[model samples]
Every structure is written in C-alpha cells, then in structure tokens.
Target: MAKPQKRYVCQACGSVATRWQGQCADCGEWNTLVEEAGATVTPFQAKHNLQGGGRTFQLVGLDAEIALPERMGSGIAELDRALGGGFVEGSATLIGGDPGIGKSTLLLQAAARMALAGASVAYVSGEEAADQVRLRARRLGLGNAPVQLAAATSTRDILTTLGQGTPPALLVIDSIQTMHSDLIEGAPGTVSQVRASAQELIRFAKERGTAVVLVGHVTKDGSIAGPRVLEHMVDTVLSFEGERSHQYRILRAIKNRFGGTDEIGVFAMETSGLSEVANPSALFLTHRDEGMTGATVFPALEGTRPVLVEVQALVVRLASGATPRRAVVGWDSGRLAMILAVLEARCGLSFSTCEVYLNIAGGYRVQDPAADLAVASALVSALAERAVPADAIVFGEIALSGEVRPVAHAALRLKEAAKLGFARALAPVATAGEGGMTIDSFKTLGSLTDHLLMR
Candidate 1:
C-alpha cells in the first residue's frame, strides 16, 4: 500500500530528477524537465527478489555453425546497399532525419515495393491521416499497391489489432514521436513515453518475427530526438540527410548489428518519388571549366563506395583596419579554421588580411580528413589566382606540422578516379600510382604549397 512517487525527467537527455528544475543538469538545457509518475514498490516487493523464477537460456559456443539470416529486399538497390543487403526478419530499425527530409516518402516507397513483391506490409501513420497517405501514394504511382495503411496514434490499439491476425512481414511506424502509450503517464514525445513505447514495439517485433521500421524526429542539432537509448534498442539505425534546397538525399547507416556501419545509400528526390542514384559521384561533381580557379576535385570514400566531389574556395583581401570574414558551406567551419592556421604557420601562406569563403560543390558535405589536401589546394589556388589541373584529383591529410599524411583506400580512390577519366592524382608521397594514372606526390604541405605556387 505505498504511494506512487513523482519524478521529473529531462526531455533532452533522458536524465531523471527528484523534482522539477529550470535547467537539466546533465545536458545544460533549460525548460526541458517534465513530470512523470514513478512505479510504486512496496517494502515486501523490494526485498522479495528470488533467483529461481526465471527461465535460463542455453549458452552457445563461438565456433557453433549457423546459417545467415534471411533478408527481404525492398526492391531499391541504393536502400539495399545502405542496409547491408536487405531487412532481416525480427529486426527493428530506427531512421531519423530533419523535417521535410523525405523520410516518410522513402519508407512509403519501400513499403509499396515490398507489397508488390508479395510481402505482407503494414504502414501505420501517426502524424498523417490515412487519406493523406493514400493521396501521396497515388501521386507516386503506387495507388495499385496492396499496402495496409492506418492512421492511429494509440500503441495499445496498434498492437492489439496486429496481434489478432497473422503477423506481417514488415511493419512501418511513421514517426515514433507521435505514438502514445497508455502505460506511460506523460505525452507522446516525452522521454519516458518514447522509451516505453519503443520497448513495447521492439518486443512485438522480436516475438512475432516482424521487421519493424520506426521513423524518428531529430533535434535542432540533427541528433535523433527522444531518449538516446532509443537508438540502442533497435537492431539498426539509419540517418536520412539532405538540404531543403538540394535535390539529392543520402541515407547513412549509423549502427547495424547484422551488417557494416558507415555505409551510405544515395537518392534524389523527384516529383514522383525518390529514385536511387547508382553513380552518386555524377550528382556531387559539377562540370570542370577549362581554367576554373579556386576549385579542386576530391575523391571521398564512403564504406565501399567512392564518390567524387568538388571543393571550392574564395579569398578576397580586406582593407587594413577592417576585420576579415570567414564563411563556409557544406563543410565544417572548425576544420576550415584548422587548415587555415596550418597554412599560415607552417606553409608561409598569409591569409590574415583576406576574407575566406569555402564551399563543397552540389550541396555535398565532406567529412573525410582526406579532403584536407583538396581544400588546401583550392584555398591556395584561390589566393594565388591560379587553377588546379582540370583533370587531376586531390586527396590526403595534413598535420599541424605541415606533413602530408596518407589516407585509407588510396588504390580504391585512384581506381574510381581513373574510371571517371581522371589521369593525374595529387596525393601523399606514400600513395602509389595505380591503374596507369600519374601521381604528383608531396611529402609535406609546405612542398604542396610551393608546387601550387610554382605551377
């Protein structure tokens, strides 16, 4: 006969507090704490834990032989590539992205395709009405698909209905944030509610051997909203990323228990639906003008695929007594600052009096450290009013001491570049020339700057 205790949880970081507070002590965010009811445990219940009530599982040896898990393809090559082949039975997947990033569209397309391929698919939308989703499906030319669609937010109703029938091969929940669980006290998007709802759905997925796909909303900083444990509860985590003004979207695999992580699937959003891009390099790399200054081609490797993108830089000298401005797009500003510092201190380049602007062409974001060489080449070319070779690609890492460092998959990058009609490479000295392409290797960043200046 104990009273239920009240607890406050931080919606930002899932930290629990005894009482309401203005700021979350763990995440330093203000106005995110919300109250929730904690379970009541009597004194007898707390001390009556016995070890004999649980069923034990058999321990298996590491050398035990087993068959590979069966996969169900969504009939999309790029998506299959990112998923490390296809969706596995009894696996739970969580995909998150910013608003209007085509997450629901992509999932709808997959569900339609799977339904057409004779797989039992169910799509439950919590944010949109059934008629609205149907209208979109018709617009996407999937009106004939036999996909079971519903628009309900109650987790209990969804589970109860699905439990009465044969379990579907695939179940897609459009947006976990809008799902409400009656067992939890708070609203849908609260930390406790999201965690409890996801746990229930994942349990259903495991017990019924259904592959579940859960859509998630993202915070302002682009991380998945709700509890961080939500990501860990799923068997796989995918990120859908794209700019609103851009036509291309990338599906990146952040975590996978059945496959390799960091794999990416490229797609372009069109009027009809999302179409897979087999050659993503073509979308990110713009046409190279004959003598375009401040531009360099870079080979970026994502998982097993190689993509070529262009790096562009601009430098304008500012008048004395005026503060110089630094601007960047589609790349990290902190990394750009580091590169500028290295060029000024170790390579004898002076950019203090100039305003610098850096951009990655075609709205593609570059995260590879190998882009350092390409970025430096672009900056040096811009400041000196010179142009890098139109057919040459650049990739390598630069240290603070100015030494050019070799990168992973050098031969793979060269091979990809060669396939794209590039004949020369400006890379680290340790990188060997492959596939009959010439390599202008530099040992240090100082040497690279000298070469660019003298060219």
Candidate 2:
C-alpha cells in the first residue's frame, strides 16, 4: 500500500501547501497552517481513463424555460424581509454574528413560527442539547410549536435519519462549527471538516429541495470563522449586527443569489422574543427639548429604507503643548479625518489645536455619503458653540473640493424626515421637497459654513 500523502493547509484561508510554512502565502496570515493527511492514490487509480466511462446529459440554452423556486415564509416579517421576501427552496443560507447576539433566539423564533404555519421544520443543535432548546423555547413562549428538535453533531447520523423520512421543508443547523463528518479525518471545526460538512449539507438541501439555514460564529475581527470559500458556497449570506448594550438588531444581507444585496431588516429584542420594528427611524431619533451645539439631524438611507438619526460632534480646546485627539463612534474615523481636513483647508477653520469627538446617536451606524453635510454641520456647530436649527434636517454628500453633491433617493429621505415633523431641510442644490417643508439648498460647503457660522 502506498503511504498516505501529507500536506499542510491554512486554517484561515484553506490554502494547501506541500511543505509546512509559518505564514500562508494566499492570505498572509501567520501560524495558521496545519499538517493533514491527503488521500492515497494507487498507480492504477492514477492511470485510470475518463474519456468514455461516464454518462452524458444534454445542455440547454439560456432561453430554456425554468420554473422559479418556491419561497416559504417563516412568519416573521423582519426575517422574511432580510431574506428577500422569503426562504427559497433548495437554497442554503449562512448567518454569522457574535455570541449572545440572538442568532439562536431569532432562528428558534422563526422555526417556531414556520412550524405554526403548518410546515415541517427541524432544528439540529450542535452546541446545545434538546432539553436546553426546549427550555429556551419555553422561555420564549414557543414550547407548543410543532417543530422537531434534535441534538446531534454527527453529519452521517443526521443525513441518515433525514434520508429515511420525508425531507423537512426547513432545516436549521444551530451552528456549523461543531458538526463533524465521518468521511473527513480531522476533528470538528477544522478547515477540512467545516468545508466538507457544509458541502454535504448544501448538497442534501439542493437534491432534496429543502431550505437549509446554517448558523456560523464570527471571529474577533467580526468576520465569519471559517474558510473564505464557505461564504461563496452558500446561496445567501446574512449578517446579524448590533451593539451588545443596545436593544436593536440589524439583519443585513451581504450576498444573495436570489435577491438584492444590501437589503436590511430591523428587529428589537424584547423579553417575549425578537419583535419587528416597523419604523426604525423613530427608534434612532431622540426627542430633545431644545437643539444643542454639536447636534444635527441626518436622514440616512439603509438600503431602501430611509432612517433619521442624529449626528453629534464635540470640539474641545486642548491645553498648550497637548496633542489634539480625535475619536469617533458609529462612523468611520478616516472619513471624519478627511472631513476635518476639508474644513481646515477649504473653509479656513482651525481644528489642529482642539480635540474632536463624533458620534451617531442610538448606537446606529451610518455608511451613506449623504451624512457628510450633516457631520460637517455638527462639527462646525461644535467648534462655534452654536446649535443647528432644532426642526431642520441636513443631508448631502460633500466632495473633497467642498462642493455639496447630490445623493440617491432624495425624495424618499425627505419624505421620511417630513413625516417625523421636520419643517426644513438643508440638502443638495437640486433636491426637491414635499409636505410643505422649507428647502435650503447649498452648492458648496463654504455656503453652508457661512450660513451656520453667520447665523
């Protein structure tokens, strides 16, 4: 018998190497390579011919008519929205989040709702036992749902049992890291084991026309803990994001084969269970008796939804000989620095002798460029110790040259702001207004700076 070949594989990126190396050449991660035994191949197997040994199938053209995959609702509107309407049959989805971030709770609630809707659903837990799941269900008041529960880690056993009966319409794997495959040699959570286990489960889902939802753990850097290919192999990738100190959770789809990317679903975690937040804007806006310096209201767009959030900034004069400090939360520090540079260079503002702090209210993150004008307004207001108009909202992209640029969905954002009782908006020059709200348009940052400072 030929000796089994040995190889090294990077646990982080799944790059294989013939010899052991300290660093992975593919991803540049150090000390992640582990030695593993490769499959043995005989001389006869190596010389086997494949020219005429297998069956052939006809290929169809792009115009071939095919039925669209059916979608099954989980009875949770927020979850369904995040999943692009609903879960598609024969699809595999991977959800990643930090521990205690309600990944299991959300899924359990969804599974129970689906079961209540008269669909057969099975939930397999690799981290928790069936009794623990039952207790959790009781706590969430979903103990009476007809959802099947099992606590198993062996992929072979799970597949064997599912193969014997009618395939469930939905199958949820509590976590993919703890699952082990008998065909693979490595232990559970290893790169090979994770890849192989996910492959088998995905294959079963496609062949049996069942929807599979796989729970994944995130690394300290907030990325899914597995090979990069693990993300590519799934049909949909959803990220559960929220600050542990906050009660709101955001379900965002980063990649989807059957739906549009960047779509978000909002949920509020409560004692009963995760409740859907129909109006997310109201959750992020704080009612203030009076407008204060360094505070500006910004209408931000999260995917297709327009949300109103407050942007705050503080500028404190540093003592002589002290280095100025800059800190930011819920926004990019680099972008903040860039905006500061523009203020100093284009608007003739002095910030080098002061410490600046920026924050987005309600612990919500803002990625839209339309926030640039609002952020700049807050910073300048802080520096001048003057408050922006309490009933006015600001939104527009600021170019490096200090010009205010137009953003998409201007009408949608203004409508959302108007519905929240804002009487005026400071936006790009071309933005149109509705609902009798006063529109103040600025072509350049200098005009906005002059208006705020000269007031």
Candidate 3:
C-alpha cells in the first residue's frame, strides 16, 4: 500500500513544509503548525496558469502592448475627474464603505451613466433583488439607459452570464463579501473563499475589457474586511467615507494604477440620488449662520482640485480630573495631537485642563496643512469664546519653532479662495510670494496669538 503523504502546514499562511516547529515562520503565528497532505504551489507551478502552459510572468512585457485609448468618460464630471478622466479597460476597482453609505447608490448611478453613454452595463447584486435595484434606478431619473441587473451570489454564475451576454461596457458587483465559489471549501467570507473569488473575478476583468467595480465591506477599524490580498489584487481601490447621518459623502482613492491616488470625489445624497457637489466649498459652508466663533474657512487641495472647507472647533475647561481631551471628527487624530504639541511647546499655550474638539464641517476629511491656520484660529476662538471673521480663510503648517511653514500649490489654494468670495486668508509667510491673490503672511504662532486674543 502506498504510504500516506504528510507535510507540515502553517495555519496562519497556508504554507506547507516537511518540518514542524513551535511557530509558523512563514506567517509568524504561534503553534499554527499542523501536519497534512502537502498543499503548496512551487514557484514554477505558479508562474504558469492552472490549465497548464499559460503566459508566465517573465513572458509578459517582452514588448509592452501599445497603450490603449484614453479613459472612457463616466458621464459624472466629478467622478470622471476622480478616475483621472474615466475607466481604464480591464481594470478591477473595489469600492468600500460603511453600510448605508451610498456604495450601491453611487454604482447604480455610474452604471446608468455608462448606459446612457451608449455603453452596455451589467449590475450584479446578491443582497438586493433585481426589482428593488430597478426601482432605485427609476428613482435616479436615469433616462432610458439600457442597463441590466442580475441578482446573483455565485461567482461562477455571474461569470457565465457575462460570457454569454454581449460584452458590457462596465460590470458592477454590488459587493465581494457575498460572492461564493464552488472551488473553495470554506464559507463565503472566509479568507480562502474571498481570496479565490477575488482572484477569479480579477482574472475575468483583465481578460475582458470591462471596467468592474466591486463594493466591499468595512471593518470597525474602517478597513475593508477581507484578506489583505483583496486590496492588492484590484487595479484601483476607493473608499466611500462619511457619516451616514449626513447627506454628504466623500469618495477617496486609496489605490489607482491609472490615476493619482490622492483623488477625491465629493457628492451629496439628495432625494433623487447621489449628485456631485460641483462647488463643494459652497455646499460645505452653505448652512453657516454667519459670524460664528470657533468657525473657519480653509483653502485646500484634493488631488488636482482645490477646495475651501469650513473648520469648527470647540474648547472648554474641564470640571474634573479627566485631563484635556482632544478629538477630531473628520480629520486625523494624530495630526490634531501634533498640532496640540506644537501649540504647547512653541506658543506656550496650555489647554491641559480643557477639552478640545475639532470638526470639519460637511463630514469631509481635510488633509491640507493649509488648515493649520484654521485649526489654530479655531483653537483660540474656542478657548476665548470669540468668533472668527465669517469671511476669514486660513491655511498653513505650524512648525515646532512656531514658524508657519510653506506648503505646495499656494497658487491653486489662493485661486480657490478668491473664487469662493473669501475676504482675508492667513497663509504661511514663505509661500505668500507664489500666489498672485492677496493673503496675509504670518511667520509665528505667537504672532497670531494677539490677533486671537483681541478678537
């Protein structure tokens, strides 16, 4: 009788080995070693496809294929811009966000737009029935776009349908978590199944010239919940981020093979559907009651687009020994901490006994250091309970030495501020020479201290 073959398997990473150990060196998981039948792909085996001889990695790029035509327009100007002009053929895109965060809504809009552009589109959803999707489509006011919908959960069935139908201009998978494959032995969302399903779909996208968008689920940490490979496998990855309580949603590109990764798309969820906020700054500041203390308008850039945003801050003295709390809703917490440290060390400002809360109005995340001036201004306003000028605009990076440091694209930021009817802008002194528009230059945080105190 043939002897049963045995091999060591690392449960953490699925790497196979002949020797066993207390820990899996392949994946660094402690005591994840178990003996099983050998299960691993040799480097030679992986270089080719499963069916036998296919294009090897080394065989590719012998002579790069001529670049394809320019991106196909998505019809929504803002989304087109966010996608760096449009969809690249055969690119796999993963869009992830919180539940009820407009993931399906956005894709439905895109599918209809593509269909209106005279391109065929197929939308697959496992969670929603076709009738429900069609009902939402009617609500979007999509005028006679020849878009098709399918309620499918099986990856194979979707692939088969795609193969049988006319090649679609785009394919929309409502989500990846719901997809299951018969080739994998695990549950739908298990690491193995997700990986296998994603790989198969990725292959399908690349083999066909369809722009496929996969909606994904986000974990509590705000990361897409799946094997890390799910992220690496896609050509582009975007996240739909916002508070569900608010109507505004921000689509940010985390990965883009054909475009800049820093691109962001702003939209508003209205009674109709997701509508692009063309002048997002105006929308972000529309609800302002005017002359409010602890409020600031800040000029910033997202990818190549410039925007002005309202920043609000609140500071209050603590009644107990809980220590000063600093929290930000739409900006980086680490960034706020860094600014606070700068304030304490450079300007000798002590809010150790106070509570500080910062918010970027409109549920938008601000990445521009230009907001430094706004944050500082807001901090002062909150502490003193004084209102910042309604027309005041602020942007600058603060150094530990209290110096206002220069930032990139001063011209763009200034142009945006000027276009927005902003009266005065406090920016870094160094970049004051770059932008043609008028702006106040401040070098030190201490210099602005009196201005805050006086206000």
Candidate 4:
C-alpha cells in the first residue's frame, strides 16, 4: 500500500517539512512541528495534469444581474449590527475567544432567538453533551425555544443527518476544533484535520443555503486556533473579547466580506445570559462628581459608532538612578511611550524621572489614533496636578512634530459627546463645533501643553 509517506508539518504556519525539526524553518516558531502521514498518489495523479474530466462551469461577467442573498436577523439588534445588518444565507462565520469568554453562551442565545423568531436552527455541540446544552438553555431562560440540538463530532455523520429532510436556516457548530472528518488522516484540531473539516462544513453551508456559525478556540496570543486558512475560508471572522474580571464583552468583526470590518457589538454578561448594551458609551464612562488630575474624557470611534471613554493617567517621581516604570492598560504601551517622548521633545515637559501609569476606564481598549490628544492631556494633567474641565472631552492625533491632526468622523464624535452632556471639547483645530458645546481647538501639542500648564 506504499506505506503512506510521512512528513512533518508546522502547527503554527502549516508549512511542511521533510523531517521533524525543533524549530519551524518557515515560521521560525520553536517546537511546533508534528509528524503526519502524507497521502499516497497514483502515478497518473502525480503527473499534475488538469486535462479533461472535471465538469465545465460558466464564467459570468462582473456586471451580470443576480439576486442578492437574503439576510435573517437573530432577534439580537447588537449582533445584527455587528454582522452588517444580519447573517446572509449560505454565509459562514467563524467566532473565536478565550475559554470562559462567553462564546458558547452568545451563540446559544442567538440560536434560541432565531428559533423563537421562526427560523429553523440546529445546534451541534462537539464539546458538550446534548443535556448539558439543554441545561444551559434552561439557565438562560430559553428552555422552550424550538431549536434542534445534537451532540456529535463526526463530520460525516453530521452531514448525513443534516442532509435529510429540509435543511435548517441556521446551523451552529460549537467549535470546529472538535469536529473530525473520516477522510482526514489526523486527529481533530490538527492542521490538516481542521482545514479539511472546515472545508466540508463551508461547502455544505453554501450548497444548503444555511448560515453556519463555527465556534473556534483561541491560542494564548488570542488568535484563532487552526491553520490560518481557516479564517480565510469563512465569510466573516468575529472576535469575542473581554477581561474575565469585567462584565462587558465586545464582539468585533475582524473580517467580513459582506460588511465593514472593525464594527463592534457590546454585551453585558448577566446571570441570565448576554444582554445587549445599546448605549455602550454610557457603560464605559465612569460617573464622578468632580474632575481629578490625570483624568480626561475621550470620544473614541468604533467603526461608525462613537464611544466616550475616560483616559486616566498617573505620574510619580522616581528615586534617583531608579528605572522609571511605564505601565499601560487598555491603551497601546508603545504609543504611550511615543507620546511621552513627544511631550518632552516638542513641549519641553520632562518625564524622564517619573513613573507613569495609564488606563482606560471599564476595561475597554482604545485603538483610535485620535486618543493621542486625550492620553497626552491626561498625562500632562497628572504631572501638573491640575484637573481637566469636568464637562470637557478631548480627542485628536498628535504627530511627532507635535502637530494636532484631525481624525475621521469628527461630527459623529462631537454629537455623541454632546448627547452625553459634555459641555466643552478640546480637539484639533479643524473639528467642527456641534450640540451647542464650546470648542477649545489646539493646533499643536505645544499649544495644548500651554493650555494645561498655564490654566
């Protein structure tokens, strides 16, 4: 039988090696190579000829008229919004998160809502038994939802059962890592196994016109576990993220062929299940009676949604010859260092002898570059021991040359801040005033520094 040729594969990059090695040559990752059996091919198949045998398919023009795929909501407004209105028929979505981060709970809740809304939904759990899922449903108050449930891990059996009768409108596989395909020569979650299993499931989803949601386990670095191609095979990639200590969970779309990326859906984990947070800005902002040093409000934009969050900082003088510490949470550490350097070089403010601490309120992470101005404001306020205006918000991009740059969606940010009762804004010079709020525009970091120190 040709004794099935053997080869080594890198789990990190899916690269093949002729022999096992301690480090992967392609990805440079250590101890990721594992041996696997290579498929034996006949002489004729090894020739790599593409001549004649496959069915011919017609190629259509880009402008050809075709009906758009229908979208069905899961009765969850936040989820629908993050999914670019709703889940498209025949689409495949991959969602990944840390363990205990509520990936299964969110999917089960969505499935229940869809079933209650009259959509045929089937949930297959490879990690848990059917009764365990049922118990969870009961806990979530969805015991009466008409969603079909099963506990299976064999891909062939799942396809066989799903192929019978009418195909369900929505299908959820509670983790793709646990699914095994008979055709694959390795255990489930292996590089080849994951690739092959996902391929079959995605093909079924497209052929059956069912929206399939696949749960994925994440690695220590917070990326989906499996070959990188698994993410590319799906129509959308969602990331469920939150700190275990925090009650808020963020559902972010990292890749979406049918929708905009970077869109986020906010949810609060309660005893009943996940509840949507329509006004996430309010939840992220900590209400305080008075403004304090090192605290600044920043209007951050998440996709099309504007969120107002507090930027807090602390600066303490370090002992002589002691290494200054720079700690940051919910904001980029490198960016904070760059901002501090700019403050010293451009604004003549020295932080070389100070230990700095920065944090974003409510365990929320900020990625927007417009947060530069706010973070700088907080740092300056901390060093100067002066509180920024209690009702004022700050946002803008700070360049290395200390130039205050304008950011996108300025109007949306201003309106949201105004709606949140922020009476004044310290922003870039180009930002337009809105919502009857007073504007304090700055043209450079030096000007902002002067305002903070001089005030």
TM-score of each: 0.88, 0.87, 0.81, 0.88
Off by over 4 Å in 4: 1-56
Model 3, 1-455: lDDT tens digits are: 23445689888898887788998877789898998765466566546667865675655565888765557788887777777778888888998999999989888988898888788889999888988988898888874678888999899999988988566878898779989999989888788888888898889888877788888888999999999989999988898888888888888888988888888888998999999988887867745556577888887788888877788898889877777778888788888887887788877787888889999877777877767777988888777777776666778888777888888887788778777766667777765533345567788887776677775
> Which TM-score value belongs to model 3?
0.81
Q: Which stretches in model 1 have alpha-carbon errors above 4 Å? A: 1-54
Report the C-alpha displacement of residue 196, candidate 1, in angstroms: 1.4
Write model 1 residue lDDT over 1-455, tens digit each, in one string: 87777899999999999999899999999999999989897787767877667889999999999999999999999999999999999999999999999999999999999999999999999999999999999999999999999999999999999998799999999989999999999988999989998999999999999999999999999999999999999999999998988899999999999999889999999999999999998888888886899999999998889999999999999999999999999889999999999999998899999999999988888899999999999999999998999999999999998999999999999999999999999999978888899999999998999998898
What lDDT does candidate 3 reach at residue 117?
75
Candidate 2: worst-modelled 10 consecutive residues by lDDT:
284-293
Q: What is the model-wide C-alpha lDDT for candidate 1?
A: 0.94
Candidate 4 versus the native: TM-score?
0.88
After aligning candidate 3 to the native by TM-score, how far in Å is the CA of 373 from where it should be? 2.8
Off by over 4 Å in 3: 1-65, 286-291, 318-324, 385-387, 433-436
Q: Clashes in model 1: which pairs?
A: none
User: Model 1 TM-score?
Assistant: 0.88
Backbone clash pairs for candidate 4 read none
Model 4 error, position 76 (Å) = 1.0
lDDT of 4 by residue, 408-453 (tens): 9989999999998999999999678999989999999999989988
